[model samples]
Target: MVAPLRVGIAGLGTVGAAVVRLIEEQARTLSARSGRGIRVVAVTARSKAKKRTLDLRGIDWVKSPLALANNPRIDCFVELMGGSGEPALSAIEAALKNGKSVVTANKALIAKHGLRLARAAEKHGGALNFEAAVGAAIPVIKTLREGLAGTGVNRVYGILNGTCNYILTRMEQEGLSFAECLKDAQRLGYAEANPSFDVDGHDTAQKLAILASLAFGTKVAQSAVYVEGISSIAPEDLRAADELGYRVKLLGVAVRTPKGIEQRVHPTMVPKSSSIAQVMGVTNAVTIDGEGIPAITLVGPGAGGAATASAVVADIADVARGIRAKPFGRPVDRLRDTKKAPMERHEGGYYIRLMARDLPGTVAKIATRLAKEKISLESVVQRHPEGVDATDAAKKASPVPVILITYATSEDAIHRALEAVQRDKVISGRPQVIRIEKN
Candidate 1:
């Protein structure tokens, strides 16, 4: 019988420990599927004394993660360390240099250094799999790499960050403020204490960069992604979304444009009728639009110890079965350099909210500005403050909030129009602008 596939896992965090337990508990079944027994031979963590639920009786404890990755007895190195630099990068590098297969859940690492690592993996005759890096347990990477390989994908998009989704979901369902919902998310462990990475749309940007490479066969361009967070999404935004037959979601969207590929992560107004709009809480959903297949939406748990571990194990199983492919569905050298479509060139409908002074010509001036930009108005609604009548509106100097939904127009046009409106001093505050996503 062939020797068992020896595995070395670095980091004993919740996901790492769960991976160890999963491999052992499903050893018999895994062996049957892969036609080769899979065994954990070595492991490393910051602290071996730290109590964990998994039993590590027979597994060799390596003092350094890099040493474990370079261990001759190990065929696969599983990296669960959460960072874009240092130990994780070096360990994976060492393992690949030694021709060992690698499985990682580090999105930041892959987003930052994927091209270099992919080249290394190809040159060294080893597989680098990161199924857990993007949407945990969702099989999005696998789907894009294998299932839809023959199809030409036009767009790749999703709610890639669970923390942002959880916060948005709670805010909409409970009518809570963004701060209140974020606090609840943190308490529930859905968000980090310093949630900027997730809430500010950086996390989604990283994941989208990976997906864009796979779907478009373009170079991973994390730096080119236009990012906007849900921090500005107020309760009023949600209320307006509902009234306008839409829902607000922090979406990571990458699409093929005439000029180039467009990648952006921001609060998007999705139609309430769309499938993705229904995906609530911490769940993630990825929609791929391809040539043959119009669109396919894959939804599942985006993160968590077990969910991420499950994805890691799947990649390991593929490695064991010798089913490895290019990291981005195409050879790293063959991946084309992506031309980033400028955000100002983006064409889409927009939801604009302006606090206009209750003066008679204030509303007309706003329209004049939009008309000057050749931006057509889909709808314009002027709302008075609560308990105020039409007569009171004429007498008061307080600003009346006016909501404008514009027809499809370039982002440049909207910006110029809003700038002109602001200069006129008819609006009381900075206007809120949320892009409308027809998807």
Candidate 2:
């Protein structure tokens, strides 16, 4: 019988504990497949006395993750400690420098320093695997890295964040505003106390940066990706979109164009009949378009301890079986430099909502601005005023809100026209604009 692969898991949080459970439950099957057993020999977290559900009596408990990473008994280092820097990065670096293979679930770390870490792993003759970083249990990173190895990938995009998805899904389905749905998500523990990273689309952008590198063979640049949160989306916009046969989703989109890559995370208007449009709540769906083959989409729970741990264990099993691949699917040196396409060059349809003065020429003025920019309006819906006071019409008139769906046009043109319309005296307040994506 082959000897077991010694694993050191740093961080006994939800994901870390799930990894342990996976190893325990799938031990026999994994052994049969890999011809070697996988065992967690050491574990580390901030506190040793913290109550946990897993059985840790027999395992060695280290006070710090750095000690676990450098432990002589462990052959593989599993980093479940989140955060882009500090103890997590330090431990990962130590493990690689010491010639131990490293497996991590840290998307931020991968997005920020993937190239450097890949190079380090290569120089040290150690493997660096992070299948859990991109899509939880969806195996998306592996799919892009190996399944589509022969195909030339043109674009990769998805609904990468669960928190924003949950909020937007609730807003559309329950007729709740962004704030109300976000509060519910937080109460349900789907969102963190500091939910800015997830709600503001930064988390999805980080994952998209990693996916872009794998799909297009480019260096990952998280900062370059354009991001827009769903916080600005109103319930009225959701209802208006639904009336037009569309569903609003927080979509992380990456497209490779002749000029460069266009990566963005925003609330998009998807046709209600589309498969991804139906992926509501905390679930995630990733779609990849290759040069020849049909587009492939994977949809499942994008977060949760068990799902994330499944991905982590899959990487562990691959390591045990001696299966190895490049971190971003190509040699680090061969990966092309990231060239970011400016946001203005992005072309798409748009959903615009504006509070216009209830005057006769207001509609014509708005239409003229859009026509001047070559943007055609597809549909317009005028909302009736409710709960208006008869005496306050002159002091604070509740102007009519006009919602319009526009035909496809460049983002620059749409912005220029919207700016022009907002500045016009006919419009009562700041106009709200959201892009429409045909997925």
Number of clashing residue pairs in every model? Answer: 0, 0
Give me the displacement of residue 230 in model 2, in angstroms. 0.9
Root-mean-square deviation (CA) per prediction: 0.9, 2.2
Candidate 1, overall lDDT?
0.92
Give the per-residue lDDT of model 1 (tens digit) for 62-97. Answer: 999899988999999999987999899999999999
lDDT of 1 at 154: 92
Measured with C-alpha atoms, the lDDT of residue 308 in candidate 2 is 96
For model 1, the superposed segments whose C-alpha errors exceed 4 Å read none
TM-score of 1: 0.99
Backbone clash total, candidate 1: 0
* Ten-residue region with minimum lDDT total, candidate 1: 390-399
**What TM-score does each of the candidates earn?**
0.99, 0.96
The number of clashing residue pairs in model 2 is: 0
Q: Which regions in candidate 2 have their CA more than 4 angstroms from the true location?
A: 386-398
Global lDDT scores for all candidate models: 0.92, 0.88
